[model samples]
Target: MRIAITGSTGLIGTALVRSLTADGHHVVRLVRRPPRTPDEVEWDPRRQWVDTDGLAGCEGVVHLAGAGVGDHRWTAAYKKTIRDSRVLGTAALAEALASLDTPPRVLVSGSAIGIYGDTGDRETDESTPPGHGFLADVCQEWEEAAGPAAEAGVRTVFARTGLVVARGGGAWAKLFPLFRLGLGGRLGSGSQYWSFIALHDHVAALRHLLDTGTLSGPVNLTAPRPVTNREVTAVMGRVLHRPTLCTAPAPALRLALGEMAGDVLASQRVLPRRLLDSGFSFAFPDVESAVRAALTDTR
Candidate 1:
């Protein structure tokens, strides 16, 4: 299959490109800048400009282009950037794909479990109602922007991802060094549920979705068992052979992250019910095992 991808330099996109290429699929990267190679297609989501002719033969599209929610302080401008990046990028991709002579069979657009907001301890699946907040609003708009592709009879899948656990460059990566030095601790009251998934499983589940025609809409790319923030700290300490004795209070988080503190402390007890029901098995289904594998150099 020929696959066109946006955000190919991102954590998930990088892994997806490697895996998809290894599986013998042709991959084209959609770039915001001028195309430097035959494999790159120029696109400007903000301007709604895409090289539709270059994407003529794409069999599938994985739209992962978006501003990183945790990458910057949540200033008013940064918040708008977050929303615009997803909404505009997705809208552009969907519109472009809709214009293709042979439109892609599937559009696995990126989303987040943040759409569910603070779900407390409730196990949320695809059918669950979206909760309130900026993140939720952003996700809602992001998914809605893909309406063009879906309305054109294209099979669209919104990968409502969770906190992806990986060795480098993700949330867990930043936490690993601190935890390994025995400086890790629980956040806030340490009771908020943290829904997460291993990077390997995340990529694999995406591949599964690409192959499965029945799966579409919002699919939670999370583990079956969700853990509390305290549990996460304890498990990381156990894995790293360290002790979690300190506490990072809500005030400190608010001071450091500003309005993004809500994101850091939000409780989203999501479940991969759709994926599981579709018979997609996970490589790391629990926090303990997932952390060990992700943090360790060897499997």
Candidate 2:
């Protein structure tokens, strides 16, 4: 299979590329820069320009391009960047795929569990209604932009990802150093459910989606068991052999993160019901075991 991917430099995309290539599939990158090699295709999502002809031969497309939600302060401009990056990129890619002579059979576009907003402690699956807020709106629009391919009879799967736990990137990476230094703590009341999945499982789930033709629409790419912030802190402390006594006050987080503080303080208890029902077994379903494997995995 020939796979084309956007945001190939991102943590998830990087892992997916390696996984697909190791499985003996040809991988092409939809890059923002000019194409310098046969495996790279140039496109500017902001300008709504893509080389449809170049991507015509692709068997599948994994759209992972987007501005990092936690990478910057949520200023008005940065918020727009976050929204535009996903919507425009998705729209452009879908349009290109729709115009292809041999359009890809599958489009595994990126999404987030944030689409469900603060679900409290409710276990949300693919069938649950979307919640409110900025992140939700962005996710809704992002998935909607892929309508073109879906309408054209292409199998479009939205990877509604959760907080990916890895040693070098994502939420876990940011927390590791703090926990290692004995400065780790829980956020807010430490009761908000934090839905997370190990990066290895995340990549594996994506691969499963690519291979499974019956899976489509929004698939919750999360773990079976979700933990609270306090539980997460305790596990990190245990893994690092540190005390979980430190705590970040809500006031300080609000002062520093401003409106984005809710993202850290809020809870989203999600479940991968669809994936599990479809017989996709997880490599790491528990927080402690997932953390240990991710921290120790060499590849």
Candidate 3:
């Protein structure tokens, strides 16, 4: 299948491209810069412009381009950047797909589990209503921005991904160094649940969403077993042969990380209800397995 993907160089996007190409599918990367190769197409999301014609032969689309939520301090300005990056880019891509002479059969747009803010001890899924917080609001708008594709009769699936347990990028990237150096500790009260999935399963889930014709709306991408921050500290320490004796109190985290600390402290015991219901199995479902998969080549 011929597919077009945005954020093609990102942590998840990069892995998705590798997986798809390995499966013998043609992949086209949508870029902000001018097209440098036949597999690249140019588009400026800030300008809200996409070359619909250039995307003519794509049978599917995955809109994964967005600003890194944790890349900067969560100043009011950077928060706006995060929201605009997702909302604007998704809206533009959906519009372009709607205008295509032969629109893609499916659109697997990016979303985040943050939509269910502070799940606390409660385990939520895609069917659960949105929760309170700035990130939740952004996620709501991010998924809704793809209304054009659904309205155009194309299958649209929102991938509400959890924290990916990959060593190369995302939170795990920073965690690996800290844990390896024996400087790692639990965040906040060490009780908040951290829903996570291995990068291998994450990439596979996106491809599954693209092919699952009957699946639409929100589908969470997370492991079956969610672990708390304290448990995570223990797992990291065990996996790296280190001691887990340190802790980052909530107040100190707030002081050091500012608004970003709230996210770190937030609890999300999310389950992949929809993904499981759709017959998808995780490659790394347990915390130990996920950690090992990220650190070593268990594949």
Candidate 4:
């Protein structure tokens, strides 16, 4: 199968490309810069432009391009960057795909469980109505931006992902080092739930979305069992054979992260009901196994 992927250099995208190519599938990378290789295509999401010529003949498209939400302090400008990056990019890609004479069979658009806002201990699935807050508003707009693709009869699946467990990137990248030095512990009250999925499972779930013709709309890419921050800290310590003694106070985190701290401390107990109902299974469903998998899956 021929597939086109945006943000192919990102942690999730990179791993997905590798997994697809390992099975002899052709992969086209949509890059921001000039096309440097035969498999490269140029796109500028801010301008709502993409080289559709390079996306031709693609059977599947995975749109994951976006500014990192946690990469910078959430100043007014940075928050705009985060929102615009996802909304505008998704709009551009969806429009481009919709315009194709022969559109791809499916589009696995990236989304987040942040759509549920601070769910506290309440469990959420795909059927739950979107919640309130900044990330929720951004995520809702982000998914809605893909309307063109769905309207054009292209199957659009929003992969509402959770906190991916991996040593390579995301929040885990910073946490792994601290935990290795025996400085890892719970955040805020340590009671907040974290819906996490192993990197291996995350990539596999993306592929599942691409292949599953019967599935559509928002599908949470999270483990069935969500764990709390305290449980996660314990798992990390157990997996790395280190002591978990540090505790980051909510006030300290807020002072450091500004508006972004609310997201960090928010509790989201998300579940992969759609994925599981469609016959997708997680390789690491529990906190301990997920942490262990993150330790081994460097990519």
Candidate 5:
């Protein structure tokens, strides 16, 4: 498949591009600057501009461009940046695709498990209604931004991704070094459920979605099982052969992280109901295997 991707430099995007290209698929990267290579296409979400001609014959589009939630403390301005990056970027991409002479058959627009808020111990799926908070609102707008593509009869799938456990980046990147040095510990109460997926499985599931015709709407990109923060810490320690005894109190997290602490400590036991039902299997369905993969991927 010839796929055009935004945020192609990001954690998941980079892996997906590599995996897809390895499988003999053409991967086109959408960039903010002028196209530096034949494989790149320029786009400006802030200006609501996309070079449509460069995206002429894209078989699919995976919109993953967004400001990193953990990239900075949740200042009001950074929060707005996070919101606009997803909302405006998606809207721009969708509108641009809708105007294309040959729009892609599938648009795997990125969403997040954050949409469900703190799911607590209860397992939430795509059917769950939008949760309350800034991220939830952003997710609602983010998914809705693809209206043009859906209206144009394109297969628009909202891939609500979970905490991607990978070596290069994401939450695990920060955790790996800390865990290796015996400094890693749980966030807040440590009982908060964390739905995580291996980078390989994440890339494969995305490729599966690109071809799966019957799937649409909100499909979670997560492992079959979700583990608690404590469980993850234990697995990290085990994988890295280090001690996991330290603890970060909720008060300290709040003081240090501000509003971001809420998300860090939030308990979300998300499930990939649609992905599982659609027969997408995970290479690392458990936390231990995922941690191992993270280590192996790093090595």
Candidate 6:
């Protein structure tokens, strides 16, 4: 398969690109700057511009360009940046693909489990309606921005991703070192459910979305079972042979992360119902396996 990907340098995108190219697939990376390599394509979401010629012959496209939610303190301006980066970027990419003479067979646009905000102790799936809060709103808009591709009859799938557990990047990148040093603990009350998936599983799920013809709309990219923060702490301790005695109080976290802390502490028991029903299997289905995979860099 010849695939085109935005945010090809990001955590998930990087892994997906590696996995695809390793399997003899041609990968084109969409970048914001001028093309620096033969496979590089320049695009500007803010300007609503995409070099369509570069997208020619793409059998699939995985749109993953977005501002990191935890990259900066949630100031008003930075919040807008987060929203625009995903929503506007998706819209631009979708429009570009829709205008293509031969659109890709699949459009795996990025979404997040944050769409179901603060689902405390409640299991939610792709069928659930949008939740409240900033992330939820942004995710909703992000998925909606892909309307053009679906409207143009391209198979568009919204990958509502969960907390990716990996040593390479994302939240787990910071957590791995802390837990290894016995400095890691649960955030806030330590009871919030976290729906997590291993980096390998995430990459596989993306490929499944590209290859599976039946999948479309909001397909969650999460593990089967969701664990609480306390449970995750225990698993980390067990996996790393370290102590999990520390704790970050809610007030302290709120002060530290600003508005983003709420999301950090939010309880979302997301399940990959669609993925599972579609016969997708997880390499790491539980928190312990995921942590071990992250620590050992094993699939």
TM-score of model 1 relative to the true fold? Answer: 0.98
Give the per-residue lDDT digits (tens) of candidate 6, residues 220-285.
999999999999999998888999999999999999998999999999999899999999999899
Residue-by-residue lDDT tens digits, candidate 3, 102-134: 889999999999999998989899879999899
Off by over 4 Å in 4: none
Measured on C-alpha atoms, candidate 1 has an lDDT of 0.92
Across residues 1-299, which tens digit of lDDT does each residue of candidate 4 receive? 99999989999999999999999999999998899899999999999999999999999999998999889999899989999999999999999999999999999999999999999999899999999999999999999999999999999999999998888889877899999999999999999999999899999999999999999999999999999999999988988899999999999999999988999999999989999999998889887898887777644
- Tens digit per residue, CA lDDT, model 2, 20-136: 999899999999988899999999999999987678688899999999999898999999999999999999999889988778999999999999999998878888999999999
The Cα local distance difference test for each model comes to 0.92, 0.92, 0.92, 0.94, 0.92, 0.93
Answer with 1 or 4, whichever has the higher TM-score.
4
lDDT of 3 at 94: 96
List ranges where model 5 is wrong by over 4 Å.
none
Distance (Å) between predicted and true CA of 170, model 5? 0.9
In candidate 1, what are the lDDT values of residues 1-299, reduced to their tens digit?
Answer: 99999999988899889999998999999999999999999999999889998898888899999998889999999999999999998999999999887789999999999998999888888899999999999999999999999988789999999999987666778898889899999999999999999988999998998899999898999999999999999899988999899899999999999999988998889999999999999989999989877866332
Candidate 2, TM-score vs. the true structure? 0.98
Under the 3 Å rule for N, CA and C atoms, how many clashes does model 5 have? 0
Error of 2 at 268 (Å): 0.7
Tell me how far candidate 4 lies from the true structure as C-alpha RMSD in angstroms.
0.8
> Deviation in angstroms for 124 in model 2?
1.3
Backbone clash pairs in model 3 (N, Cα, C under 3 Å; residues 3+ apart or in different chains), count: 0
